[model samples]
Target: MLQSTEHCHIVRNSEILSGEPIIRGTRTPVRAIVEMWRIGVSPEEIPQRLPHLVLSQVFDALSYYLDHQVEINEYIEHNRIPDELIDPRVRKA
Candidate 1:
């Protein structure tokens, strides 16, 4: 594991996921957890959906999100596909 703050399970390394904050010891981005929660995935259900993570890791990801919403939200928006590029058939109403 990379050197991390004593109080949190989140870490960022330039070599990992392009330095996005992630759950320590894993490549799971904090944004992924935020997105899941935003879409209505409960904390208890997160681990079931992502078998590699535990409830604690999910919580840590969330805590990271709360501490850095702007950065993560920007990353999310930056990664979003433009509407024009979406196929009409797959676009949600």
Candidate 2:
């Protein structure tokens, strides 16, 4: 079953992505949407890149990010590969 916040399209369920805020009815994390936007993927392009997500869902994810920057940033950092764990040759400059 899917759950929803009264103000947004984001949802959280313990069984889904370990309870990370995700687009309702999908496992796509809100952080994922923010990261794409941060990397210059426009809202218009997000749905094209992730066809499963409608424009409203992408916008909601971004709105959620704006309202909870620290939370989502922590999630991004926590899930990122540690620099030390990367092979030196494969690490970006």
Candidate 3:
């Protein structure tokens, strides 16, 4: 994994998610944390949702996103699922 100089808990590894910044030791992308926060999951509670993460890792992921909004947002936007793209089995009736 490629360690990031910008944040202690963040790293980029080409083998992982096309090198998107992720929590240092996990495949969880920084954007995943950011999106959870954006949707109103408090940082303290984030660890409850993703048990592998601790509060510090959540904060650092948020910090990394703030420091690199455009980069991370692009990842978010690019990965967003349009309504039409949702699988029929999962779409609400």
Candidate 4:
């Protein structure tokens, strides 16, 4: 699982995203992973899309989500853009 101290493999610190918890070194947030799983994406497919991540990390992140459901879910909800501002076609829009 991703310890709070362990930097995400995809999340980045951009002044724009309010420094939200992201996938690692990018603006992609951990929420994306949660959304993908919600949509039936297999754990194996994640690595193909995110070559930088190992399957273990992906699983670990999910485990982290399960263990910290309330905190992580709140983070996702807080970071979510409003429907009035986002395109519905976007993954988690």
Each candidate: how many clashes? 0, 0, 0, 10
Q: What are the models' TM-scores?
A: 0.87, 0.85, 0.89, 0.63
| Tens-digit per-residue lDDT, 1-93, candidate 4 | 322435345333646366555555445566677767878988899878887777776776777677667877888788667887876677462
Worst 10 residues of 2 by lDDT: 1-10
What lDDT tens digits, residue by residue, belong to model 2 across residues 1-93? 456665378998889878889998788999999999998999999999999999999988998888889999999998989999999999989
Model 3 residue runs over 4 Å out of place are 87-93
Off-target runs (Cα >4 Å) in candidate 4 are: 1-29, 88-93
lDDT of 3 by residue, 1-50 (tens): 48575789999998999999989889999999999999999999999999
Tens digits of per-residue lDDT, candidate 1, 1-93, equal 254644378888778878888788888888899999999999899999999999999988888788788999998998889999999999999
CA error at residue 36 for candidate 1, angstroms: 0.7
Best candidate according to TM-score: 3
lDDT of each: 0.86, 0.89, 0.93, 0.66
Q: Which of 1 and 4 is the better model by TM-score?
A: 1
lDDT of 1: 0.86
For TM-score, candidate 1 versus 3, the one ahead is 3
- Evaluate residue 12 in candidate 2 and report its C-alpha lDDT on the 0 to 100 scale: 85
Considering only N, C-alpha and C atoms within 3 Å, which residue pairs clash in candidate 3? none
How far residue 21's Cα lies from its native spot in candidate 2, in Å, is: 0.2
